[model samples]
Target: MAMSRNEILDQVKEVLVDALGLDEDEVTEGATLMGDLGAESIDFLDIVFRLEKTFGIKVPREELFPAESLMNNPDFVSGGKLTPKGLAEFKARMPHSDFSKFEANPDINKLTDLFTVAAVVNFVERKLNQAA
Candidate 1:
């Protein structure tokens, strides 16, 4: 059974709230996991684990967030910054993310700024669809 967008959002919100110890109201669709909800890298792991259990779907860490690997790649990072190719690949991988602000001065450190609650929902939807 394919879950609707709203269903996905609700499950994501619950997962985030549980993982981050946040209130339900703070887990809106527009909320950024790190910025708005205060999610750290470790929190991301917890969220992924919860999501996998809740949805019964497996999620590869690299598939969901490739920042760490990308940063280590010489082609992706040169002069301590993401190359044009790197930015393009990031955008391609994270279509649900809003890169308008980050496009001008892309910083790998600010990668969390791109992760919104909607992005997680979209990711879950894609994975569920693939499983179906």
Candidate 2:
């Protein structure tokens, strides 16, 4: 049985609540895992693991959170912001994420802001749909 988007969001909220020790209220759809929920890099690994378990689906770390790879690569980032090519690549990689705000700044530091609860739901929704 395929889960609805709301169902996926609920489960994702649970996963984040447990993984980050956050209050359920803090896991709203627009909340960024890092900035809003105070999730560190290590928490992302646990969140991915929990999501995989909850959905019985694979959640590739790189696919969901590709910041590390882009950060270290000079070609992908320059001058503390994403290069034009990097921005394109980011948009491609995180299609589940909303880039309307980030596209304006393209600051590498704000990359984590893209990792919102809604983005996680979208990723899971895509994964489950793909499996179906």
Candidate 3:
């Protein structure tokens, strides 16, 4: 079965905490990985890699770094400063699907978790399959 949004978020947080050596309590749904977690550009990439590994998702570069969108988000100030509200807003803006049922015609909000997990898993599976 696929995971819920909350479940994915929790797992993301856990992977972040472990990879970044941060306190679990500090990594909340409203915490910005770059702002609150002091993640530099390279660190951010590391986080992304960890996220992909943990969640089995392959986040697109455009989704990861949308220059225009990032500039508009409140969490990112002139110098990439993130506030708690910004983090919350960022999380709220993430693409989410229900991941409960498989469907040919999916409602925007009713997408199965497999879709989300597949982003990462497919990448790994493809690579591994090719290797074999």
Whole-structure CA lDDT of model 3 = 0.48
Candidate order by lDDT, decreasing, is: 2, 1, 3
Per-model C-alpha lDDT, please?
A: 0.86, 0.91, 0.48
Instruction: Note the clash tally of each candidate.
Output: 0, 0, 7
Give a tens-digit lDDT track for model 2, residues 18-126.
9999889888999998999999888889999999899999988999998778788888899999999999989999999999999999988899899999999999999
In model 2, the runs with Cα more than 4 Å from the true position are none
**Candidate 3 residue-wise lDDT, 11-120, digit = tens:** 76676677778888887654444556665566657766886677556655445443336446544432444344543443344433222342332222221122232232
- 66: Cα error in model 2, Å: 0.9
Which of 1 and 2 is the better model by lDDT? Answer: 2
Model 3 off-target regions past 4 Å? 68-132
Winner by TM-score: 2
lDDT of 1 by residue, 15-126 (tens): 9989999999988887888888988889989988999999999988877876777778888877766799999989887776778988888877777777889888888988
> Comparing candidate 2 with candidate 3, which one achieves the higher TM-score?
2
Q: Please tell me which model should have the higher lDDT, number 2 or number 3.
A: 2
**Alpha-carbon error at 17 in model 3, in Å?**
0.4
lDDT of 3 at 74: 48
